[model samples]
Target: MRAIFFDETDAQAVVARLRADGFEAALERERLAGEDDDEDHPWAVVSDAPAFMLEVLVDTHDGWLDEGDDDAGEHTTPLAPLDLPTAPRTVKRPDLG
Candidate 1:
């Protein structure tokens, strides 16, 4: 699957994390037309991992994935956090008198 990232660093970070997690990932430079050298262009992250896993990574790291097709045609959305089956967190507040 392919997903758009903000910049090369973010793309590389995703690739590194995926590789560390035992998934193959790579980045492809996507330059827009009429963009100058100084302008920031986005990169696309390509991975061979499962969609769910990619989604999780994207969600946790603030990335976005391509959601192909709907009544309104193709669109992209930020990955939503998965509902993991885990224990809830406990927060302790400081005693303020």
Candidate 2:
């Protein structure tokens, strides 16, 4: 199980808690391309814990899971494209009486 955390303190807390619970966990830096700010890089926690266990911790710590790098196995369906108008939106529509 893997979790990405924006706060270093949260990441460390998770790691400590997991270790205390007899689970193997490791914390590392998660860097993405085009991310110029070094301090903005999120922290990654890789552990041998179960998904549910990790999910609970992640939810409580304001973090999210990194379910591999593949989006092919995702079950979610993509939403239809929005047809946005090019012109400025009016404050009041004539049809809304």
Candidate 3:
């Protein structure tokens, strides 16, 4: 999960809290396309914290959650089985043995 914050302090705070609570968390720079200002890039809190926990933090920090890929939460079908020969083939026409 990812949460974006305009304030670096807020992003750091959230990461600290998540770590204290025993969840994997880290901070990074989030660059949005068309944003020419290099210093204006937002800070992102990347974490394995629960959605509810991150949602509350995002609300308090004036940021939003970037829930990546709409289809990411959906289930995917398993791979199809492969076809095989009815019997094992003989090795070297059974003459090398």
Which candidate number would show the highest lDDT if scored against the true structure? 2
Cα error, candidate 2, residue 79 (Å)? 33
lDDT of each: 0.76, 0.92, 0.91
- Global Cα lDDT for candidate 1: 0.76
Task: Write one digit per residue (lDDT tens) for candidate 2, span 1-97.
Answer: 6899999999999999999989999999999789999999999998989889899999999999988855534557878899999999879877986
The TM-score that candidate 1 achieves is: 0.56
Q: On a 0 to 1 TM-score scale, where does candidate 3 land against the true structure?
A: 0.71
Q: Which residue pairs of candidate 3 clash?
A: none
TM-score of each: 0.56, 0.69, 0.71
Model 3 C-alpha lDDT per residue in residues 1-97, reported as the tens digit of each score = 8999999999999999999999999999998999999999999898989999999999998999999873455556656898989999977866766
- The candidate, 1 or 2, that scores higher on lDDT is 2
Between candidates 1 and 3, the one scoring higher on TM-score is: 3
Q: What lDDT does candidate 2 reach at residue 19?
A: 94
